[model samples]
Target: MVGRSVTAVCLAAAVSGAAAWAGTQTQLPRAKALAFGGRPVAAQRHRQRQPSARPGVGVSMNVHEHHHDSGERYYGPASKPILDAVKSPADMKRLNLSELKQLANELRWETLEAVSKTGGHLGSSLGVIELTVALHYVYAAPEDRIVWDVSHQVYPHKILTGRRHRMHTLRQSGGISGFAKRSESEYDCFGAGHSSTSISAALGMSVGK
Candidate 1:
């Protein structure tokens, strides 16, 4: 019963966030005008950069095209359906059930890929992709804290939040920590390196709230 109530709360929060995001998008024209003095930053940057006549300077290279012959196999549409659209939980809220399922698949694949490359908690992270997405979709994160027990399973959560771009930096020197740390992100409400403390930490946050 408690679990179901928590799920309900999360879903309500996700919907609210989605509605807010939609509204924000509608106001983008005005926001852009204010942000960039009526000219977009992208246009300004493009105009500012003139190609250098000097050899070996300002030379554009197509590094991604030839960096790996098998890059398409890893990053093609089949493996990254809903994942590419998701920049945060607000984006996840825009997805329907079918899209959410696709997102889960993409999350799992991305997690596997990152783990294979960086060597961290693969099995645990793979096992919780759907659960993490569902939770983030329902709850207002960084506000309604979702504490993980022995947070080796939190890679998917990190990716769903604002840290997907940083997945390649997992567990490296000066990179994201292997376990959840409050300092790492607002989404990481409670630090978890060991088991059996998540419930207590969540209770503490709940009571404090």
Candidate 2:
């Protein structure tokens, strides 16, 4: 059973939908934004740049030399669902703790595969892999919102919250979005792109509530 009192502090419950990405695109209403104290709410969008070949795409988690101990992420494309990886927030809840840990590894592996093809954030995803799994396992999706910042780390969020099938379409035109999109799912509440907007967005949400 998941700890009731909780051991680690966390982000919110981010879930639902697929986003369509374009060149150096601004991603608002489709990523980031969430409540404090790890309360689950719908996410806001975060518009940001997604240039082709900026850096840190497709690199392996263990293969890279830079700060692997510091938790380097590998958001590269992986072999097509060769494994039965969790694809949604509910999916995560259905698994046992041991299973969840394995799922996290696969998510990272899949993230590596996906990001490599599209060439986006990798390190952040790697660092947050365990955290993402725990959140999904704890909260129900489409209700709770967990905002991300500099949100290229959205890879793991996408896979767990029901966008695994579209992994290959990441960061592509007329494909999937790189940032969180409200249109994509109710899990997204506010939009973001630049930094310093996440906490404020969450605060506004609390006031509105």
Q: Could you tell me every candidate's TM-score relative to the true structure?
A: 0.63, 0.60
Model 2 C-alpha lDDT per residue in residues 3-122, reported as the tens digit of each score: 222122223322221111111212111111111112122111111233335456532212112332455342333443423555557755667755655566567677766776778766
Q: How well does candidate 1 score on lDDT at residue 17?
A: 50
lDDT of each: 0.65, 0.53
Candidate 2: where is the Cα deviation over 4 Å?
A: 1-85
Candidate 1 lDDT over residue span 1-209, tens digit each: 02322221232234455444333211112222223223334444554576677777674522222222333233324548678888888887778876777777678777877876788987577656666777777777765667677688889888988888888899999889889888989888778775777666666665565
* Total clashes in model 2, counting residue pairs 3 or more apart in sequence or in different chains: 44
Candidate 1 similarity to native, TM-score: 0.63
Clashes (N, CA, C under 3 Å) per candidate: 3, 44
Model 1, stretches more than 4 Å misplaced? Answer: 1-79
